[model samples]
Target: MKIACVLLLLLNLQQVRTDLQYDSCGYWTYSKGFGLPEFTERIVLNDVTVYYHDSSLRSKMPCPDWINTTAGKEEWSSIHAWSVHSRYVSALGFQSATKQFNLTGSLSDQNIYQASGCCSLYPDGTYRAFVTHAFNGKDFLSLDFKRKTFVAAVPQAVLYKTLRERDSATIEEIVAYYRTRCLDRLNILKQAPGVLIRKVPEVRIIEQQKVGSITVTCHVTGFYPPVVQMVWLGPDLQPVDEGVTDVLPNEDGTYQTRKSVIVPEEDVGEHTYSCVVLHSSVPDNITRVWGGGKAGGMAVWISLVCIWLLAAGIGLVVWWYRTRDAVI
Candidate 1:
């Protein structure tokens, strides 16, 4: 459960930089009807989580020596206290916001609030960053660096923008954090005693013979960074039409996904079909070909596989947990 909280936190991070080092942090709270809200705080460096605190656990999640996180008790306590205060304030905010929008929902409907910030640093020593917030899974407000002010993502958020914009000091503080603290953390992570480990994607292919066609499935797993590209290649080495599944998170924070295509029975021996994967972890694209000698030698069965980065709504993560349909 503790580990799940960390993985679920990944849902808050909408997009990840494939070739940049980043320091991103977010505090998320989930509530439903009258139940006490559950809160989680997370710090991610280069898309890998280094620090995590779950309100239910009441402690920072543990990490191995390779992922060294040196946060102290004072930091955890302060974040926890802040989360508690946030839960209270967010509850009131949600009520008023819902009323203002004339939105109606069932009592069982869930509510979520999150404040997330991220800074991405390039090799050339330049950085881009922002601090943003969402309420009930909609973008409420975001920091505009150029104007040094808050902007509303929707009409419903104009009230928040007006309120925060009036507080120039708060805006300055957010910009300072983005420019200094966030980027500093990225630098520290880049120079940490233990460098970020890159786990290459393990690729394999399985074929299932049906009545008039054969289905070839390329299973890629055990990869880090959670960003991967997989495509089906025809015998001519051209991209082929295929069905790809969502990237699923492994317990160890790695990811797995599959791309499958069907081969006509008559064209089975024509040539070969391949699954080519591109990811940051690998120096070159990994290709797994199906057909030829392997076609003759058969395997009876093949075993299977973050489901996040869900922009627009982080509430999907809350729903997955609220109902145990699927739990990583």
Candidate 2:
């Protein structure tokens, strides 16, 4: 009887261990063999969802006052550095999010980069997002976790309500509005077959420093089939004579273009500069400017020349008045 009791106790203990193991391993079983980290943060905005994965799970928590916290600062700094060092991550995230959310009306090879964290307000009070991972190259589909459901925040819920509305406008309507309001009317004249304006080009100012003169270098990309004319524009809407160069083609067939602008010491603070591309598509002209700065060199020079001409004219007027009095 003592031996039988001992056997029964051992059997019960083994069953408890098996149950615990099954519970813990349940989450891992659905992972599909992908090696994603244990900690994950999923953010859903409107019809779009973004998942951020971190091996340390630091990014999984709510970032209340994230801008003021050390982790926030570190993330910000790392993003800035990443923007310079490995911008491919940024590019991939943007492309993936837009496609995943079905934001673009037509399925084309163009990649759209949402600088505002994958969330943007639509005309019909709806919000759209392009979700991505916070880590260097992580993405939503790349997640190896088995959990199918995630918690939704208040803002995310609001976005969901907006997207779920049936009366919301379609992407075609939005594109039509954009075409009429933003694009140049003259572009209609240039439209033809095989002259597609694939994707709108984007310009990102990577580095700006004043080594005697203000030297500005920018990263430009996101156009398909390339453009015949890509130039830098000044604040006055005139082209600058900056040397433009094209970077090597990425494996995905998208090209990275760049242009450098050198401003004289005196005119560095005078005008703003922008990267402009002229494509053969619907929006024939696309421009992207840096966050803040005065107009470019062309604008400054033209303004200065106009001022000098005005001053000379004023001097001539005074001389004419004095000469008239002498003749009298």
Candidate 3:
């Protein structure tokens, strides 16, 4: 019997763990360049596109000093142009932004080359960098800069196979090279002048009267970098298994999320519930409580007393009017 009870308890704990939802987000960084008549440069973090520059828009707006120089223009016009054409032919249909270059210039050659790189910072304090070079829209080569190995995105063409066999020594030397060349550049571009830090989320709790019970909702809003966790806690400070809504993006680049629980009618006034929020910007978890806590209970009682006093005064006035009419 004791063993059965222990197994049952463990099963219950596992269920509880599965019932409460959790969130884990990481940092993503990518650098892309487009070429020719429509030169473009961009950097993205997570899924949000942060920095973008279009050669088309350069004439209308002042160009940033870093990529606006004569040598910069030439490099973008030639090399980045080759990258965009490679993407156009490879046609991988990546969800990331696509660039189309005018076919007028030196791009008449069927051969094209591209170089794109991405770095990711995981929550566990580890980082990884990946780089890919494509030929005429087909993957030609890829490297896991951190692992110092070549990844087969697609089968190596005869030329690549022959070159790899001959230059294996050189490839080995530069396998770890992108740590500075690409990863550091990605970080530097993210911190360029106009980057905005994600704001701390604001949390509030409100009670709603349902048919036979009360539903308490914790509303969180006005935060950037859009990942957050909010949970409703019962009297024991354990998370309640009630439903939580998905985080919705607001118009102003902030995000809003809500989680709710239906409290028993009897627990409304007797027990206090709490909403705990976890976000990256906040060092400590934020807690908001309802049901007769210091702040919430005081306000509720004051409002109730004011309503009672108003009702009593109205009743007294009505009584006085009736008595005056009887005397007349």
Candidate 4:
């Protein structure tokens, strides 16, 4: 089983998708694997990538109480050292996760890293620093700072242990490797896809009736970069805030999404509703209109079906009359 796992890991290493994301919060680094040939069966994109943010500084932005004093400003300037140490805290939390790791069969696994931290100057000219790794995303391991421990995962602990035993690694050494080597590599890997790939989405407005309730849905599909927005507009041109689904992955690596609003039965009228989709690639918002006596209402479908039946009936009547006359 162990040999098989190693082989699979090596096989998956042919392509890498290293995500180096840095927002207003802080910097993060992680590596992921995408298998070759059948690129659809990606591993790293599916795995949980770990990132830690120094919310301590962000929480006190635009001159917090800590920065009021010169001493506090000095501590803040040296935050890089603090940030590196915080990463170790986050890794410790990764090692402490309790989730079971599958060894033999399918390699789909979930990994969590805790990411939160704090550094403050004490009254005796001493610094009391503690880093906690926790985030708001689902399955992110949380650290109880007061207790100074993390909830460990079995797979994470095993990996950490193996690395530690291999090199007699200390916390400081491991943290340095992550900051200097891992993150730098990630920065390079992130730049591999130089040009931003953008695809304008195909948007359409549709109406669905179920249990007497009509849902006006805007179906948006076949887009790249996945960043998109859909908004429903009333006939008055005001924006209607409806729920939109997250951009989901398509087989071709494009994205698809949907947004919907429930229209009151009485309010259904010709040209009463429209959906507008916005994406970076689109020069203008794609507008799809429904209702207001348009082609996408339940009434319109019923009318079309009736019209087809009426035409069929007329043709049958004409044929029968001709045949009867000939027989007489």
Residue-wise C-alpha lDDT for candidate 4, range 1-328, written one tens digit per residue: 5434322332232111111122112323221122211101110111122222333334322223423556444534444454554455445434443323333233323334434332222112222233233322334433233333334333345444443334433445534433343333333223222223466788887778867568888899997656666666564434566654787988877889998888877676643565656554544346666773543566444433433343345435544544454310
Per-model TM-score versus the true fold: 0.65, 0.28, 0.51, 0.37
Residue pairs with colliding backbones in model 3 are 35-81, 90-137
lDDT of each: 0.59, 0.38, 0.50, 0.44
Residue-wise lDDT of candidate 2 within 135-185, one digit each (tens)? 112323221112212112222232332332332343333233223321221
| Model 1 clashing residue pairs (backbone) | 249-306
Instruction: Tell me the tens digit of each residue's lDDT in model 1 across 97-133.
Output: 5655766666326666666777766322446676777
TM-score of 3: 0.51
How far is 304's C-alpha from truth in model 1 (Å)? 27
> lDDT-based ranking, best first?
1, 3, 4, 2
Least well predicted 10-residue stretch by lDDT in candidate 3: 17-26
Cα lDDT of model 3 by residue, 182-300, tens digit: 34434443433433455778899877888889888899998755667666656534457676579898877778999988987777676667676666555435667777443357544
lDDT of 1: 0.59
Model 1: lowest-lDDT 10 consecutive positions: 299-308
After superposing candidate 2 on the true structure, give the runs of residues whose Cα lies further than 4 Å from its correct spot: 1-197, 235-238, 290-328
Model 4 misplaced regions, further than 4 Å = 1-112, 115-196, 209-213, 292-328
Maximum-lDDT candidate: 1
